[model samples]
Target chain A: MSGAFISFQDATKDYGSVRVVENLNLDIARGEFVSLLGPSGSGKTTLLMMLAGFESVSGGTITLDGKVINDLPTYKRDMGVVFQNYALFPHMTVARNVAFPLEMRGEAKAVTAAKVKKALDMVQLGQLADRLPGQLSGGQQQRVALARALVFEPRVVLMDEPLGALDKQLREQMQLDIRELHHRLGLTVIFVTHDQDEALTMSDRIAIFNHGKIQQCAAPREVYDHPANRFVAEFIGETNLLDCKVSENAGETFSVTLDDGSVVAAHGLPGLVAGDRALLSLRPERIEILPAETDATATGQNRLAGEILDTIYQGDHLRVVIETAVGQIIARTDRKAQEWPVRARVMLTFRAADGWVIAP
Target chain B: MMAMSLFKSVYATLIVGFLVAPLLVVLPLAFTSGAFLTYPIPSYSFRWFSELVENTVWSRAILNSLLIAGSTTVVATLLGTLAALGLRARNLVLSSQIRTLFLLPMVVPAVVLGVGMQALFVRFGINSTYLSVIVAHSVIAIPFVVISVSGALGGIDRRVERAAESLGARPHKVFFLVTLPLAMPGVASGAALAFATSLDEVVLTLFVAGPNQRTLARQMFSTLRENISPAIASAAFVIIVGTILVALLLLLMRRRSA
Candidate 1:
């Protein structure tokens, strides 16, 4: 958090009796791309809106460049914003739309024209600059929106679900395009989206939000591997959450007894104690099917006896659902790997280090 | 299916024919060689058309109508566009209530409104002045402006204004550069509609206007009561032409904007 360029110090928002965004304290480094990932009504978009000055912070301050900018109007905030709907001015051509910000700032006409051309060129939309927004496809309109926001040379860019309206392929391409732009310009960006895959794909760091709170904020791999709590673990990827009490707790590892009287040893994630009720988060990809006797004789890996209920062939992998003694568990494996039919009796094995324990 | 569509087109043509039958009957009579209103063996002439321009009463009524309708258009367009903007303002309380109030004239009985306005104007001692006629016409005309402009505003994405604001344009700049240009089609149509509404208004003019402010509609009403002159037919022709021009303008603006 040191040498942070943009910081939200205990910022909060309220709508009469409902407090949508609680005290949110986050520091985004200069030239960093951070995404706020959450479900609908999770206040991720609200936080981005607050930063862009579209919404006011109910308490505390949002500082940019070591100065508080909480009360600055949107026009004076000097931050670029790409809305979810693109929100292009329908009457203006693409070029005029990009030039609007420069005109607003009273920049010289020559400089404005040069910069507009450059921005449109950056988006590869220079050829279509004369077309109105309605004439462009969804992806083209999005690029125009991006160009307009970037043409002003704002220090920070905020995007609120900018790709939500696009098809999957176009969305992915835009994600990469935005990522490349961020890298090329070294621009600080705060992206908001409900899609976990999108956040993981585009963000250098992600803040997982739920109920107006940041449950976890870390690098993609860090959050995936060692989620801060059950919500983070479940929200970020597919995982089988096993409800079990802590049978034993050491500094780095623990053991838990499943409801079916099965004892499973597991590594811990910094905050579990003996006799505490904890849920063991086992990722689907981390579990592998094994022969029953080999799993029983295994020394260190955690094991579960199950009967395969179904095997779904996803494009790249197979999602196998199994009914174990405790409950249902989902395991995702390579589609070309060893086959498991329905009613297949198998033992599931996962390394103890892969089993994460979270209390509540 | 083709036959059914043919039947539908024929039905539509019949309805349109019924609607234009009066115009078809009167327009040719304006150029009638004979003095009678009947259409048996009448040849075509421009005598009535010339009479319409030559007669002082008819010419003065046309001038008065133009003046009043033009003023009503300006006043109604301004008031209605302003009211529409106010309705769109954030944090405005009872916005729909205000909108309903603006649209009330469209639904209220014309005679009732004329009577009420006549009483009010008389109390103010401006009962039969040009101001009274212009005000009454503008009041009814405002609803057209409001509806058209509001429809234009509705098609606009509100976020576009916010986008403008975010891009360093202030509120006024957003309104002028973003909201205003986007809603131009609606405003143009609203102005044209308001002008047409004022031109055709007769009941309110009769109640509030004096002889000096007698519009073409008032003149036509009185002439119909006395004798069905071909001069009235020529006046109707002028009105039809004016309305067609305005309607054409509205259509052109819509297509251009679209």
Candidate 2:
């Protein structure tokens, strides 16, 4: 945090008397592609706007390169922003749009022309440089906007759900394109998006936001595998939560008693105790279904007896829902696995290390 | 449905005839060879048109009209555009009240405005001058500019301005480069309306202008009161044709921009 390229210290935003972003602190290192992932009205976009100087900070300080930038105007902030709708100038040609920033900086005409060509080439829009923004297709227009934003060579690039308007295929392609660009240029990018998969795929680290506060901020694998709390666990992906009472606390792991009187060991949070109610988050893919006659007592795995309730085919996998003693548990199996007929007796098993215990 | 369609056509034809009746009567009389303003047309000639061009008084009045209308258009457009920008401010208090105040001159009777302006200009010692007449014309013309510019500014996406700022354009540069270019259509049409408004002004001109500052409308009024000549009809023909030309030019401009 001491060498942070951008830092928000107790930042707060209020519209009139209603506070939207409350007492937030975050540090983004140089060249890090950090994403603020949240649903609508979660203050993610507000934080981006504040950093870009489009919106003023109501409380605390935002620093860039160790200097307070709370009062800096947008033009002086040396930041580039790509809006959701592209926001390309309708009157200007594609090349002119990319050259706008250089022109604003009073660059030499010959230099500006060459830089514009290079920027357009970077986005592969060189052939369409003469077309107006209105004449270009949506994807082409988006590329032109990207070229314009990156042409300025700003200190930071803030994207506000820039691909939200694109189709799924185009959005995916753009995600890859932006990630490659970030890596090639070593750009510090702060992306805001509500799509969890997009965040997981594109971000170096994702800050999960809820109710104007960060629920958790960590690497994608860490956040997905060991979510800090129930909200993050539920928000990040689908998980089967079992209500249980902690019967034994052993620092890194604990044993919890389920509603059906079955004791199962689970990974534990820091402050968990022996007599506290908790929820165990078990990912569906981690659970393996086997025949009722199979014996797994020697494997040191948590076991449950259940009957097949339903089997939903998911193209690549089969989502088998088993009516177990604790509750209905879901397990994913390869689509080519043996047919799991309804009402068939089965045994479900998962390793203790795979079950994460979270506070209610 | 057939009967409704017939009725609509009949109503439209009647309205068109009612609007064009005066022009039908006045246009032919512009070329009348007779001395009086009668519709029977004793003879058809370009005598009145020739007289309009040959007479010094008529030429001076036409020049004065052009000078005043041109000046009024420039002054009204500058002030009206600034007012529209101010009215577009976010969280602006009394926005509606201020807009209504800007538009008040449009609804107020011309005679009432003329009386007030005459008194005010006399007190300021600028009575019966070209400045007084142009100032009076711009007061009413500004509302047209304001309405048109405001509509254009309203249609603009605010994000485009933010886009410009993010690309290192300062506030003034953004206005001159991005905002102004996007709003040019409205400003162009506003300017045309302002010119047309100033050209058609007569009641205010009579109250504030001197004999030397007489405009075409003022001259036509005095000529009508003194001697009802066919030259007055020629002047009316000229004014109507000039207005149509301005409208055509505006249409061409809008088409190019679009």
Top candidate when judged by lDDT against the true structure? 2
Residue pairs of candidate 1 with colliding backbone atoms: none
Once fitted onto the true fold, the runs of candidate 1 whose alpha carbons sit more than 4 angstroms away are A1-3, A295-299, B1-7
Global CA lDDT computed for model 1: 0.91
Q: State every prediction's TM-score relative to the real structure.
A: 0.96, 0.94
Fraction of native Cα-Cα interface contacts (under 8 Å, chains A and B) also present in model 1? 0.88
Interface quality of candidate 1 as DockQ? 0.80
How big is the positional error of residue B173 in model 2, measured in Å on the Cα after superposition?
Answer: 1.0
Candidate 2 ranges with C-alpha deviation above 4 Å: A296-299, A320-331, B1-21
- The residue-by-residue lDDT of candidate 1 on A214-249, one tens digit each, is 999999998998899988988989888999999888
TM-score of chain B of 1: 0.96
Candidate 1 chain B: 10-residue stretch with minimal lDDT: B33-42
- Tens-digit per-residue lDDT, A1-360, candidate 2: 779999999999999998889999999999999999988999999999999998999999999999999999999998989999999998888989999999999999999999999999999989999988999878888999999999979999999999999999999999999999999999999999999999999999999999889999999998998999999999998899999999998987889999899999989687888889999999998998888888777667989899999999999999999998778888899888888889999888888888999898
Q: Write model 2 residue lDDT over B1-258, tens digit each, in one string.
A: 999999999999999999999899888989888999987998899888888889989988999999999999999999999999999999899999999999999999999999999999999999999999999999999999999999999999999999999899999999999999999999989999999999989999989999999899989999999999989999998888999998999899888777
RMSD of 1: 1.9
